[model samples]
Target: MGIPRALLVLCIATAFLSLGPRGSLGRSHLHKRQQSHGRRGNGGHRLQSPVDSPADPPAAGTSTTVTPSNSSSDSSVFDVRSFGAVGDGVTDDTEAFRSAWRAACSVESATLSVPSDGVFMITSTIFPGPCQPGLVFQVDGVVMPPDGPQCWPKSDSKHQWLVFYQLEGMTLRGEGTIEGNGEDWWSLPCKPHRGPHGSTLPGSCDSPVLIRFFMSCNLTVRDLRIENSPQFHIKFDACEDVHIEGLSINSPAFSPNTDGVHIENTRSVTIYNSMISNGDDCISIGPGCSDVDIQNVTCGPGHGISIGSLGMHNSEACVSNVSVKNAVIRNSDNGVRIKTWQGGMGSVSDISFDTVYMENVRNCIIIDQYYCSNKGYCQNQSSAVYVSGVTYANIKGTYDVRSPPMHFACSDTLPCTNITMSEVELLPHEGELVDDPFCWNAYGVMRTVTIPPIPCLQDGQPESLQEIPNLGC
Candidate 1:
């Protein structure tokens, strides 16, 4: 893959690269809950969640105590304070947390508690699991790392901060907050807005990604509040059967690259009812992802939900069977986007954006075949990631007049086909101006009358059907 894709998808990089074997860590009694699958007009059916579903996470910002299920509450409790954590906000509490986890992991149905009241400061840490049975990582107190880049250990990776590896049948929910002290990292001269005139900074320019889960299955993260990450807030990479709900991810509008939730090389994921106000993409779907369902998310002061930004470095990328519905996007850079670099090789298909309300959003609905994160991340090439079977339905709201409400800037050589738009009534300048939408090499049908009427879409299929092989995960 290319360097741009490598920026986010590269194993969080170097400091810890060994994945010797999947540990025999954790598992709880499994259960399932039915959730709505698709948007309107499809007569959506309910889909059952993947096996591992313990009790729900605590509501965001609430101080609800978590108790282990089917186990004596007192006996199964493993408290960090009891393990010698001072919790005074400045002391190093990493060992205490590790001790608590060890005790909790030894027992079946145990809860590791970072109870309410203390501000636990710890360094970059990894909690590797496969423990006994089910385990709960309860965070009702404030958890943060050392203040800045200078405080970070050179021996530790700048790419990862708090990581959970090989954990299954686990629930990480709490009213408490996981604060990412990202300001200094964001201030590095190498960062976008911080770069000096034609000058480069010394040392590593990487910032720690806050809270990541790798090679885990049947995971649940809900009702949590994460803020000001040096990078992404919550990322699930190479994980399966995941469900994320009721999260509030926040950062300054200008905070660099603080994506709310990102998933890559993962499958069967569900993100529901989350409120994210950040600086970058509210949620990004990277390569090798499928069967994703996102609903009732409120995103703003950030870039909207996106797919790909893929196939960079002339690599094969595939994403399919994704749906985003009942979402509210406001004051964001883009509404719902499908982006790929010029020379990308795979395909993006079977995507839907339904019943999304946009308010003053720029590039309300867009497909950019020539996507570049920075000024020159990727150079133009003839080959492109094929895009097809995309639907934009019932998307209504006011939009920023600076850019086109709906833009389909497909590849010059490989046009986007099966691009259907229905009941999309976006009016520029706060529901008043009727600017014409833009389209280039995009072919599809408009089910009903669009607000400004898109007369630029071509009326047939492309001749590249055989070019896109189904690369399902």
Candidate 2:
């Protein structure tokens, strides 16, 4: 087999996330590629090969001056075009961008700019920091990576493409697009697509994450249009005081592993005024995350905003204080979900979703403690993540009748407690009304009447949770 169709997925507990094809965003479709893996046609744009460096300065007319707001007129602006970037669709502009970054990183409040009418193709790139504060990355034009897997840099980790490390007080905002030519990546057999292999296989399928902010702080990413990532679109890991605003992330409903906004092990986050549609979750808050507020989000044709698939591989994970409000989810698989695996230790609490509306979604609200990667049969284990203090209010939706609108399948040994629901009305979009909600070993109440009334929820805490044992959570 040429690539084993890249069969295999490994989430080491030890590891992290995946792409789904449950609705429009799953990697499970088994469609053969009509075009073989190769560099893409430039779509009327001329193509240029990568160069080691600029042998000469920019020809002219491509350079532009940039002045940061609230800064002196002398604030340095470094344009990539000035460093010999041919922003055609197929030029190797990686070195040009790096040189501009160096020049801008040296000075405080410097602006690194890209031309508004260019399509610069870069390779696997990392922008490391701890440099000058308030560095601005302005993307008024399109910045994209090499076309597909074969075009990817073999020496680089296939797990990640563009990465920013250890940056502080950096702002990345623009009116342009960061396009991921991900069609080839999504074709790998390992992606959760319809196939003989089912959804997930056990092994390694290393698809690159589009953009990652690692160990950075006080970062701002706003007003960007990102599309068709090979994997997770934007990830902030181990970052603090992060603000994401006015961003639109889009990928094909059938794209694999293309989560819109995924934040993990990060805190003090505010993701506001964003619209996400893809194959996976619109916004995924992963382990070690806290103090996250997501509002005014429009999510659809994907997995809904989720808090976890945490506590995998018997690992310890903790997530808390996440709030999602004033959101709309349409034609999605799951909405406002919390999923954790068995035999894991951790706690997920203080999460709330309020005033949200859904349309034609499969699962409007859910919590799955028996989450597994389908590696094999996950043996039922006693230990589980502690889930509590989750609230859902004013969530009205039309749903697909295949699954119940509300499913709270808490762990058998460690039942979920303090669950609250109010004014949630879910009805079938066109078919007959589905069954009542499915609840097991869950403790909660309804402050107001709900459609298909949930009489299955236990009114009091489960006796199994009376003396909660701390499993190093």
Candidate 3:
């Protein structure tokens, strides 16, 4: 008896499950039906079934097949050149995108394809709304932002850029790049003035993110290079079931608040097989997020993956069941950090960091319950964000500084608890561990194989006052 071709394809996909980056497992495979229709050829496009007409309900028992259509479709793919989009490598291609988007919406399983050449300038937002399932926004050219400040939209009612709102079953894939002409937006004159903690700046001038998705679901973004945004490169807010893989995001090292990936109030988000270098935290998971997993990511020259910096005034947030494993951090500010503002209300629990590698990072591991504002100013009100059940296992790293490799600062009011560390080893950059290993003024208990005596500072100062005290373990 011979195996059916569809069964053979399924077996092959299952075999590739563990071969690629950790995030690509289980979900990256093309649907067996899609493969049977036609083969995916050059340029990373997949042939997909025609999208069911809007009048029809989605295919039954076929919910898992909402992947994006490939670029090499026979007739449904939109060639940007046909719609007056000049690929001369210098013309503004924004209008070309608008035209292509408009045309793709009319067809079932259509692809808006941009061939590999030219720079397209996009000054306005392109809305691919009421997107049908199996629709793909494929880019093979560069999408560049307007050159200077004059081109950016002001915050007034007149200025509105790109946005993807209330769309379902969409896929954005490309081998090209999206560059935000950020200098113009970042240098706006009407920008907010500085405050005591840190100066307020202008809201991202609609040029902050090369791609923005809000209130979307079943979205997949893969195999692209996104660079140079005035703000966050990719931001997902209030979205669900989002999968991002095989992306390379690079930007200037000093770009302020240029977090590589920011997910707020989202669920079931997975990020894997990506390299992120940015000015702020490579990945910041904030309030109202759950079931988030990050694996096989490379991070360096950024703030590193962080949870919380949460509990802002009158805000209610919770982060749980988050896991990060098999990651590499090089010369980052901190590894596996959790921070919360004082006087805020939230709860972060059931978090785990496993098999993480750190090289020359500033702080190998940290949890700051008293995460004060800039300029080292502490809030008079204490934190209400409860931190508990954080575990660091199989962590091996080197700290570039002489201080204790591990630091935990819990609030005086709601102290952190149930913190555990196992098989954690840290090599100091300058000196050996200090003679004592205990927390300072922290309300929670510390458990380890050996609790060394707390080190006394030269001036008899409390542990909190001492900067980078030696951990004598």
What range of 10 consecutive residues in model 3 has the weakest lDDT sum? 31-40
Deviation in Å, model 1, residue 332 alpha carbon: 0.5
Clashes of 3: 14
RMSD of 2: 17.5
| Model 3: per-residue Cα lDDT at residue 164 | 71
What is the C-alpha local distance difference test score of each model?
0.81, 0.83, 0.66
Candidate 1 C-alpha lDDT tens digits along 1-473? 55687765666654345442112222222222112211112122212222123232333233223223312225576667656666666666777788778777777778787766667777899998887677888877788876778777678888989999998898898878888878787888777666566344665678989999999999999988899899998899999999999999999988887899999999999999999999999999999999999999999989999997898888888899999999999999999999999888888999999999999998999999988866655677988888989999999998898888989999988899999989999877554575688999999999999987899988887675455544432
Candidate 1 local distance difference test against the native: 0.81
Residue 131 of model 3, lDDT score: 67
lDDT of 2 at 373: 70
CA error at residue 261 for candidate 3, angstroms: 0.7
Q: For candidate 1, list the clashing residue pairs, or say none.
A: 24-130, 25-130, 25-131, 26-130, 26-131
Per-residue CA lDDT of candidate 3, range 1-473, in tens? 99999999998998797566444323321222211111112222212212222122222222212213222324566656545555443445555567667666666687766655445555657475786678887766666655545544353222334567777788888877666655555455333333334456445434346567889899888887877667777888899999999989887666666778888889999998999987778899988888999999998878889997787774666888899999998878887899888777778888989899888777777887667655346656744677767887778867766555677777665656666666677675455654343353343322333222223111222343333212110
lDDT at 459 for candidate 1? 86
Per-residue error (Å), model 2, residue 18? 62
Between candidates 1 and 3, the one scoring higher on lDDT is 1
Off by over 4 Å in 1: 1-73, 196-203, 430-434, 463-473
